[model samples]
Target: MKLLQRYILGELIRVFGLLVVVLTIMLVFVGLFREATERGLGPVQILQIMPFVVPSMLPFTIPATLLLSVCVVYGRISADLEVIAAKAAGISAMRMLAPAFLFGTVLAVASFGLTNYAIPWAVANIERIVTQAVEDIFIDMLRTQHLVSEPSRGYSITVHDVQNRTLIDATFRFRTHDHHQITVRAEAARIHFDLERQQIELKLRNATYSNPGADSFGDWDGTVLHLPLPPQIHATKARHLTVADLTEKTKEAVLQDEIGQIQQANEAAMLMLTGDFHQFGGKEYSQLKGANAEAVRNQRRFKTEIHSRVAMAFSCLFFTLVGGPFSMLQARRQFITSFIMCFLPILLIYYPVMFLMVNLCKSGTLDPTWSMWVPNGILLIAGAMTLRKVMQH
Candidate 1:
């Protein structure tokens, strides 16, 4: 039985490792090919940028590899009756299945390390490598002169100084929402994208916006003025930012929004206390107090977002435990059926977990950290129960 357990575990780990390599290679090549043709990135440049892109994919990659490998390894074993023979020899069903579980446990730890450390570093470099390649290409364009790059949105770009991301002279003409012709020309302009704030500031020297009924076409400055933009201004621009950065940015925004509501409420309450509690029958103070209470209620609702992220990350451990027991059950599931069933329970658990998190956030009834992990807690219990059942056989 010991020998058999070791054999099975080795097989599981072997398959999982194989799948990870195969999938990573497949994904990397397919991504680069697709980006080259569909995204208009140069093949050589995408290849150069691939080291950065690959590590960023590991969080999803490891999970997927393990999931498929688990299904295949156990499914193949059961199909061949090796699991049956091992159990018939008086070995505990889950006892013989120990190898896969250990493999999964190792993977879970590795995933945490990759997600918290390696992936972050890789994502940071993704921006750096792409930025380098784009710079070189722009420099070549400038040297060639008459080399114009037009994006699908029909905006023309010509690089004046590649080193500074400076625009020598750029013109943009497009129809506005009000159905009016608009033309923008800027001389000696610099584009600044602020990743932390998810905002863009275009500082232009001698900028001009020309259209009907405008003095100097909205460029009413000596040599330079700044134009600001949020992500909405350029849909394509959002694609360049990494997912982690975006997630963190959203978290910060939600935090700020919640704090603003709290501060406003506190201020309103203090004002009411000054005018209403101390002063007799002040109508304005009464109204201000009412507004303050409404803000308190709204603050509850806005805080839900802050808790959602931790929930997503922590759910992995719970799900792994659940999968462990499920794989060792009576009348073990087929690979495809197991996968399909896995998602059904996941979705059902997800919505309720989300609902509870949101409610907890709104009511300030529970700590967000604990509330976010409620689904994980439930899965942990379910897993233990399943493990007991499998051992009973």
Candidate 2:
């Protein structure tokens, strides 16, 4: 029994290792190309980012690779009449699958560890590295030309020219934090770089300002403006946070949003008592609505992300349960066909379902704790049916 288990596990591992390496390389290249085009990053920067990309991609790759490996290895075993020989030796079908099942569980546990820990770090690093590269190019452009345009970041600045700390024909188009568009056109501008603050100041003369939903202001004798040169980059996505961090953030948002609503309600009531009939439609109400929306989104996103990671981790074991048993019923001519039969459906169905569920969970249309596990539940049921049929046969 021990030798049989070793032989089976060895075959599975050998195939699994080869497949993992090939898949990881393919995924890394795809990621590299995608990042290069999106960020306009050079080879050196992409290479620097390659390692960070692998961890996040692994959770997506490992389950499929393991499934393929099991399909190939077990299909060959069943095709070669190994099951007949095993049964002749009084070994049950369940015993034959023991090694593969154990191997799958081990892979699942490892995947869980990586998804829970390494992925968050990798995601954060990838964002930081890419944004830093973008910031470098942005600063360079601002120094060389009197204009630096980044439509994505909502900034377009046109200055007549820059000469030893002075700018002419200067105009700045930018979006405020509240998402309002503002334009500032100045006759003459002086650039001051504050290294300590890591910000740039533009001292404008004879300036005019245009703000969203407001009239224009012009002919200012002097106006001082500060802009974040590189800007502060922060990862606001729940996926970039670990389980503990995400849970805490969700809790904090819930608490803060609730407290804000109570305060807003109290303020509105006081105003109403003072004969203000429009108190409910004031800034407090708007703020409360915004806070509530943000809180609900964060809570849903954080819950979905955490549950999805955990659910994805268990896919290795689930795939093993399905792939290992289903492969045994294939005919000799169906070796490659058998692998495809098992893999293609999963590739199409499982992923799309998982994707849909994740989106639903993130949108708060579904309960994340249950919704994210739907794919796993479906896979589990399918695997159990396959195993039961194999056992009966």
lDDT (C-alpha, whole model) for all candidates:
0.59, 0.80
Point out where model 2 deviates above 4 Å. Answer: 146-236, 282-284, 331-334
Q: Which stretches of candidate 1 lie over 4 Å from their true place?
A: 26-40, 79-90, 132-320, 330-367
Best by TM-score: 2
Worst-scoring 10-residue span by lDDT in model 2: 228-237
Compose the digit string of candidate 1's lDDT tens values, residues 1-393: 488878877877787778888888878776667645543566676877688667656666676566566666666666677666777887776676567667766677666666556655765555445545544564467546724444343334454444456666665454454645556666665655543343334566676777773433666333432323321222322223334554555566556656665765676677677764553246554555556555555444434443444455445555556665565452344676775565567668765776777677668787665676677677778878877886765
Model 2 score (lDDT): 0.80
Q: How does residue 202 of candidate 2 score in lDDT?
A: 85
TM-scores for candidates 1 onward, in order: 0.58, 0.79
lDDT of 2 by residue, 1-393 (tens): 578888999999999999999999899899889878876788878988999988877877889888888888889888889987887898777888888889999999889888878887887677667666665565456667757876766778887666556677788988888888889988888876543355567898888888856665556548787776544434246666788998898898788778877877787778778978786677866777788778778778888888998888898998998888899866343556777898888888888999999999888789878888888888889989998988888
lDDT of 2 at 54: 89
